[model samples]
Target: MAMTNRDRGGKALELLREGLSPYVERELRRFLGPNVEAEAARLIGEDRYNAGKQLSDLDVAALLKVMWESWNDVFRKTLGFAERSLVSELREWRNQWAHRLRCGQNLSLSDSDPQGLLVKPEVARRQREEEQQTVPAPTGVTSSAATGVTSYAGGESSSPTPAGAPSTTAAPLKRFHGSVALSPLRLGAEAGRIAEEVLAHLSSLPGAQVSVTLEIHVAVPDGVPDQVVRVVMENCRTLKFAVHSFERD
Candidate 1:
C-alpha cells in the first residue's frame, strides 16, 4: 500500500534531517570542537525528534526566527569558506520551508544539492573585498598650513587662524580623531564589542595610539541621536590607519 500523506511527509523530514546532519555536525564541531559531538549525541539523543510529533502543526514563524538567528551566530563564529558554505545551505533550506509554510502547505524536508550551498572561495574573497571597500577610511586632521584651508578631510572646520596671520607648518601631526554616534540598539555589550574591534584595527597602524570614547544618546532606536563616539589616536606618524564605525539596530 502507498504511504499516507503524513507518512510521506514524515519520511521527507527524516531525509531532510539526514541530509543536514553532516553540515550541522560540522558546525557543532567547529563551534564546540570534536569532543562536543559526543556530548551532543549523548544529550540530545541520536534520533532527531519523535516521528509522530514531527508532523504536528508546528509554529513555522518561530522556527524560522530561530533558524535565522542560528545562521547569523554561525556566520559570525565560523571562519573559513567550508563552514560558511554549510551555513548558506542551512539558510536556503530554512527559506524554502518558510515559503512552504506561508503558502499554507506542508513541506517534506528532503535533502537538496549540498554543493550549491557551499560558497566558492573566490566568491568569499570578493565578498571580503567588498566589505573592506564599504568602510570609510579614517580622515586625518588636515591643517590650513597644509591645504591652505581650515577644513579636515570630512569637510569639518578645524581651528581657524587670522587671514593675515603667518601660517606655520602643520603642528607636527600629533594625533587623529574619528568621531561617530551610536544608535540605541548599540548600547552596552554591543557598543563595547564594536569599540574593541575598531581599536584593534587602529592599533595595526604603525606608531598609532588607539583611544576610543563612547558618546551616549538619550534617544534609542529611532532617528539619529544627539550623542557621538569619538575615537582618538595619538602619535600617528603614518597615515595608514582606517576608521570604521557602525550603529547596530
Candidate 2:
C-alpha cells in the first residue's frame, strides 16, 4: 500500500528519534544530572507519530517558538555547556548564519564540494610568497683596518671601524590552508528567510547537520563550534529537516 504523507513523515520521525537516541541520552544525562535517564525516557515516550503530526504547517510556527524557548532554558541551565572556548566557537557559526541572512549564499556539500568548504592551495601559496617578499634582510657591516692610523698624514685618522654587526634573517612564513563553508540555503529569495533565521540561531552554537549524510562542520579555525552546532541541529530538527552525519577530515 502506498504510504500517506503523514505515514511517511511518521516513519521519518521514528528513524530520527531512533538515530538520535544515544546522543539525546548522553546530552540529557550531562545536563539533567541524575534525572537524565528518567527525563529522557519520558521525553522519548511521547508519541513520535503524534509529535510529527503536531508539526504540521498550522502548528509548526508555534512549535518552533516553544522549541527555541526550551533550547534557551536548557542552554542556560546546562552550565559548562557554554564555556569561553565553546562560546568562541559559537561566534564563528553565528557569523556564517549572519552572512547567509544578510546576504544570499548557499554552501553545497557533496562529493565534489563536501560541506561546501574548500581551500584554494594556490591562494595559500601566493600569500606565503607575498609574506616572504615583505620581510627585509638584516644589513651587514664589514670592518677594515685603517691604513694610516698615525695622525700626521691627515687632520684626523679614519674613525675606528665599528665592530662588524651580526647579520640576521627573518624566518620564512609558513603556508596554512583556510576554507569556509557556504550556507546550504543560498541568499536572495524570500524562500530562504526561514533558513536564514535558522542559520542565525545555529551559528551561535557549535555544529549542525546540513543534509542527511553530511553534517555541517562548525568547529573554529577548522570547523563550526559546539554551541553553534547544537543550535543549528536543534533548529534543523525543529524544522523537520533531516540531519546528516559528518566525518571529520
Candidate 3:
C-alpha cells in the first residue's frame, strides 16, 4: 500500500467517522453538551474551524477517542480491531514486504557478476542428473492410493488357495510430502489460523473424495524469534508443520 502509519491512521479515522457519525448526531451530541459547536471545530482542526464546518477525516480518531473515554463499546471494539490487524493482516503488511524485497535485491549482486547472472537450465539439469546418480532416495517422497490399483507383491494367484491359507495384498497407504514457502508478509502471525480455516473448508467441499493431508514448511528468516515460530506451529499443529530457517542468499 506504500502507506505510512499516519496514512493508515487517517484511513482508520475515516472509517470510524462513517460508522460513528450518525450515532453521534442521534445520541452523542447530548453528552458533548452545550459546547457542541466549539467541539465541532475542535474535532476538525483550527484550520477548518469556521462556523457550520463539517467533520474532516482527521476528526474521526479524536471523536472516537472521546467516545471511547465515554465508555462506548462500539468505538472501543472498532479501534481495537484496527489496531490488532485482526480483520485482515494484509492491511499492515506493506512496509515489511518492501523492506524484505529491498534486502533481497541487495543480496543478489556480486563482484564478478554485478548483474547477478543465473545458471542455465541445461547446466541445472546436468547437475540434477549427477546428484541423482550419486544419491538414491532412502524413502519415496510420494505414495498413491487414489490413482493406483491394488496388487499382490509376490505373485498373482489364479488357482484356489489351500485351506487356512492367508490371502494378502501389499498396498501402501497414500501420502504426499512437500515443502511450502510461507510468505511472512501475507501469512504473518495469523498464519496458523488462516491455514486451519482454509484446509478445513477445502476438505469439506462436496467433491473432495478423501481428507487432505498437508505438511507445511515455513521459510523463516533468521531475525524471527523462536516464540513466533512456536506460536505458529502450535496453532497449526493439525497438519505436519515445521518452521525452517532459511538464509536470504
* Count of clashing residue pairs in every prediction: 1, 24, 0
lDDT of 1 by residue, 1-249 (tens): 666543454355555555655555566566666564344434333223321222122222222222233443443464554554444444445444423333555443223422222223343345445765887534564445665656555456645567999875544445666666665653533453444446545676889877765443344466443344332222221433454344565
Q: Tell me the TM-score of each prediction against the true structure.
A: 0.27, 0.21, 0.21
Worst 10 residues of 1 by lDDT: 50-59
Question: What are the per-residue Cα lDDT tens digits for candidate 3 across 1-249?
Answer: 476543454455456557766665544455556676566555434332232544333234344433432323223333464433332233222222212224334221123421211222243345445765887332343224664432332343233345899976544434423345556564432344443334444455666554434344445555657787577667766544444333445
Off by over 4 Å in 2: 38-70, 73-249
**Model 3 lDDT, full chain set:** 0.42
Predict model 1's lDDT versus the native: 0.44
Against the hidden true structure, what lDDT does model 2 obtain? 0.39
Clashes of 1: 1
Instruction: Write one digit per residue (lDDT tens) for candidate 2, span 1-249.
Output: 676433354344344444534443455456668864444334334433224332222122222222232343343355343342333333334333322222454432123311211122243244445765886432222234555232321243234345795554433323222233456443222222333344444444555434212335444457776887788778887877665443456
Q: Model 3 clash pairs? A: none
Model 1 ranges with Cα > 4 A deviation: 1-119, 128-137, 141-174, 204-207, 215-249
Whose lDDT is greatest here?
Answer: 1
Report the C-alpha displacement of residue 85, candidate 2, in angstroms. Answer: 23
